[model samples]
Target: METVRQRQQRRQSDAAAHRQRYTNNPQLHKFTLKFSEDTDVGNYFASHRIDVTNSTICNHCNALKLPTESPGMCCSNGKVVLMEPTIPPLLQHLFTSQDDIAKDFHDKIRFYNSAFTFASVGVRFDRELANAKNGIYTFRVQGSFYHRIGLLLPEAGSNPHYLQMYIYDTQHELHHRTNTIPNSNLNPAIVEDIKAILDEVNPYSINFRYISNFPEEDIKNLSMLIHTNIPGLDQRTHNVPTAPQVAAIWINNNVPPGAIQKRDILLRTRMNQLIHISEFSG
Candidate 1:
């Protein structure tokens, strides 16, 4: 005996109920974090001490002192001086840049905190030097890390880039190679050193093939892959309460039991799981 209008209403109600059921299901919430290009480097440097330099240097005998039997040849002065090695400023800059990216998006991306999963891909370009006939270029790339919950909420600061992340080539390699232009060959030693460092850090994950020569299309494709794979990059349906549900819950808690009391309890419980942000909230 129902009319066409009543049938339509019933169908809509069923669809909404199904959606709610799916949103509340815990099995559907698995996700990972990915970083973006704009994450802050300064904060990362401060936290990880990546920019802190440590090195070993040879001990030498001073002019006024004689050398001991330690290793090097003897000197007139008996006293030998110890020299601590120092990292060049250019190398320090590279570590700082990578750290910045990691810190910037740590909170927004949920999976970043789980273990230490991360991935990196970069590009290498060829350019002609000012005075040389050969090509000189550098390789660089940035990776992102973020969680699924971040997509639905605004970041703590108004900075949109605050939620982004990045890592790039070292300044020393870039500047030195670029200065020599065409004459400079791909320094196998330097390349091996970089590779060793990456392996040592063991960032969540890594992809080294996407060097500076990657085309624009390739860049776009890589970017798409990052977005799809990174956790929390896209907004998804969750157990958040609608405006009416929030109002109903508020009212029920403040007043005596009413017609909406049962629904309010369901909404409040769902919101608790989906919208918890206590860590970042003061």
Candidate 2:
């Protein structure tokens, strides 16, 4: 029977411990890779020098550097792969944004070490799905995600950092973002690349983590904003829409003429899938 204060203390202690671990070992946690076809994956990996070999050290070390008829690319290490024409940054930002600025809506997020930004990532094969095809493979990429959290009470102590886990998925969040935005073009090449990646996945699980860094004062202001219900707080009528509703309305109102015409394209694509499934029988 832990009291609320005791629980808070425990959480603080745990957060401190997590931060300490991250400081000692920094890594990447949340990341994505997008490509249209098998060739694209190969090219990206080749360009990045991503090695698939199990040996930690290069066996051929200096042998491959010499000019010879049969020279070997003895680079035993490489970086993670990401296609150039993947989802644009806007959608990525939107996916990772704090939609409501003043809401008391905060989720516990973690960071790796003391880094405030992303860095090099490594991969670890958790388990391979037998269904890998078209350049898509279901495997875990080892990376570190970091967040620096400030205490609700500044006097309470140091802000904690954390390192979190990452799991991969092929559903491709880019499509969802493109669908939601008005007047956005669906590039066939990009779509094909995304589809190719999606086809490669037969995932056992995909974890969605919402993590961010914020200060204590920001938390208080957010709490006040949410508690006050500023979206509905109109000096005259008190009938204003909430923050999210306002955002939706703005998106609709600001849609370009071209976007309106193409708006149904994504919707139709989704509906057709549903219709096909509904018509199917076991």
* Clash counts for the predictions, in order: 32, 14
Instruction: List the candidate 2 regions with Cα displacement exceeding 4 Å.
Output: 1-3, 6-177, 181-184, 201-282
* lDDT to native, each model: 0.36, 0.35
lDDT of 1 by residue, 133-192 (tens): 222222322233324222211345522111111122222333432232244333344433
What 10-residue stretch in candidate 1 is worst by lDDT? 159-168
lDDT by residue (tens digit), candidate 2, 1-282 = 999999888977986686476445533222246666555565556454534343343344433333332333453332323344665443344346666421111221111111212122323333322224323454543343322322212122322221211111213333432342234444434434333343344121111122223333564522212234576576565533354322111246777666644221111232222111221121
TM-score of each: 0.14, 0.15
Q: Could you tell me the lDDT of residue 235 within candidate 2?
A: 56
Total clashes for model 2: 14
lDDT of 2 at 236: 66
